[model samples]
Each structure stands twice: as structure tokens, then as C-alpha cells.
Target: IDAMLEGFEVSKENFSTNFNGELLIITITLLSFLGLYYSAEKLTSRTSLTVSSKPLAIGLMIAIGIGLHNLGEGLAIGAAIGLGQVALSTFLIVGFALHNTTEGIAIASPLAKTKSPISKIIILGLIAGSPAIFGTWIGGFFYSPYTAIVFLSIGAGAIFQVALIILKWLYQSEQKLVQASIVSGVGVGMLIMYLTSILV
Candidate 1:
């Protein structure tokens, strides 16, 4: 496929596929939502700055989960670009960039409580997120089904583990109201997901 340089000029055929790549993309997207869910849960359950240290670790874990998912999304972007899917490439960049900004705040919130040195916090945040940059570059340069599948699966697994951790933390919380809210949020999120999956 010829490289597309202009808006609306990139053929959807070049960007769209029915094979492993598209499946991997969708899988990564769902997992990204899982990360978002965990992040919201953590923020609501406990503040990193004002809450217990136990939940602080959970918050960090959530950040890690988001980072991994973002890496897979980045890989999709790169892979699409590698295939000359310019419009898809642009979409991925914009979406991921916006997601990353929110992730930065989510990650920094808890770490801010530690009163940790700015240098250390910066390093940690970058460490958590740097993989996405490399993953995207690799996916964009080489079209490898095996690589994409492996990274996508790994990313999803990371997010899933964090979700489990969040559940456990919620279960252990002493406040009934907080626990109820967490349960309600998760129930609503899952219901919305079901409806959207069916409708979309």
C-alpha cells in the first residue's frame, strides 16, 4: 500500500483488517477500559495522598496496569502505521496521547503522597510508561503477528491482575458504604460494557 500523507486520503482498506491485527486491536481496547475501571476504583476507594499506604501500592499497580495496556495500544498504532494505515495511525496517536495524560495524573496522585523526590517520581512514571513508546515503534516498523499477539496478551493480563487486586482491596475495606459504591460502580461498568458490546 502506498503511504498516505493527506487527510481522508488513507484508504480504510489499508487501515482495516479482519485478521489477527484487528482482533488484537480490539482486545487491547477492551483491556484499556479495564485499566480505566481499576483507576477509577482506586481513586474513589482511597486517595494516595490521604489514604493508607496499603492502597498506595494498589494505586501504583493500577498505574502499571494502565501502562501495559497503553503499550499494546501503542503497538497497534505502530503496526497500523507500518502497514500504511495513516488515518488509523493518526487516530491511535491522538487517543493514546489523551489517555496518557490522564494516566500521568492517576499515577502521580499516589506517589505525590510519598513525598518522594521529584526525580524519583519522574523516573518511576517514565519507567511505567516508556514501554509503550518502544512497543509502538516496534509495531510501526515491523508487521509481526506473533509479536503483536504476545504483547497484547501480556498487556491484558497485567490489567486483569490489577483488577483482581482492586477487588480484593475493596472486599477488605471496613466501610460498608465504600464497598457498596465500589460494587455498584463495577456492576454498572460491566452492564454498560455488555450493552455497548451488543449495540456497537
Candidate 2:
């Protein structure tokens, strides 16, 4: 949501000329990601496996989404540093680190019941994190608002897809779709995120 809003804010600055084109770009990028994700999911499902693949698949999807989002974050960090906003860069780094701590849980929760190896877990962690390095490099060296908008939009799309997948999974797993525990869990998570943002 935040990433999408940021992209929207960026679009507003160029509303006279680029806004429509940016929207098209965002829509296309978002749909492309969704298509790719579903294709990959279908391909993986056809393969035979020793363990249940659904959880692993979900974890991987979550990792991918989080990775995209973190890449945008990395861009912000790199842009800050590139522009010599040292204090802002440091603040972003700290805030991102604190916020990302919870991403570990998000990535791990689905795999908790599975016997996925340490190596697999490490790979997933990398998938969710290593993009920040690339993003930082790009933002530092070739920072462009247009480029940022695309990446941020991509991140927003991926995260939205992940959220939908989770909700579908939750609906399938639970007897009641809107259980109190689920609601409270979401509320608590939001509260925590809000508090962390305050710190940032």
C-alpha cells in the first residue's frame, strides 16, 4: 500500500505528461508479475515431491514479494546516500533493519511445519534479502524517479499478490474465515508496524 502510494505521489509530480504512461507501465508490470507467479506455481505443482509443496511454495512467493519490496527500500537507502543525506540514509537503514526483522517470521511461518532443510531456509532468506544490494547499487549509481516508480509499483503488485494468496490459504485452512484470533493477529501486526514506523 505504501509503495503504491509512493508511486502515486511520484506520478503526481509529472501528471501533465507522464502520468498516463506511468499508470500503463505500472499496470503492465503488475500483471506481468502476477502472470509469472501463477505460471511458476503451476509448474511447481506438477512436479513430484517427497513433502507437501504448498507451504514451500507459499514461503517462496512471500519471499519474492518481500524481496521486491526490500529492493525499493534499498533504492531509497542508496538514493539517500548518493545524494549525501547521510543522516537520512542511516535512519532508513536502521528503520529498515528493524522492520525486516519481522519479515523473517513472515518467510518462516509457512515452512514451520515442513522439514525444509537449513540450506533451503538460507536460500529463501537470500531470495528475500539480496535484491536490496542490487537495488542500492542501482539507486546510488542510476537513481531516477521513473525507475523508482517502476520498481516500487512492482513491489506493490507482488505484495498484493502475496496477500491474496495468504488470505486464500487462510480461508481454506480455517472453518471460519473471519475468526477472532485471525483478526486480532492482524491487528497486533498492524499495531507493531505502526509503532515501528513511528520509530523510523
Residue pairs in steric clash, candidate 2? Answer: none
Stretches of candidate 1 off by over 4 Å are 1-60, 169-200
The candidate that wins on lDDT is: 2
lDDT of 2 by residue, 140-193 (tens): 999998888888878887777767766765675554657796678678778877
**Model 1 C-alpha lDDT per residue in residues 37-56, reported as the tens digit of each score:** 66656665665455555445
TM-score of each model, in listed order: 0.56, 0.85
Model 2: residues >4 Å from true position, as ranges? 18-22, 47-51, 174-181
Q: How many backbone clashes does every candidate have?
A: 1, 0
Return the TM-score for candidate 2, rounded to 2 decimals: 0.85
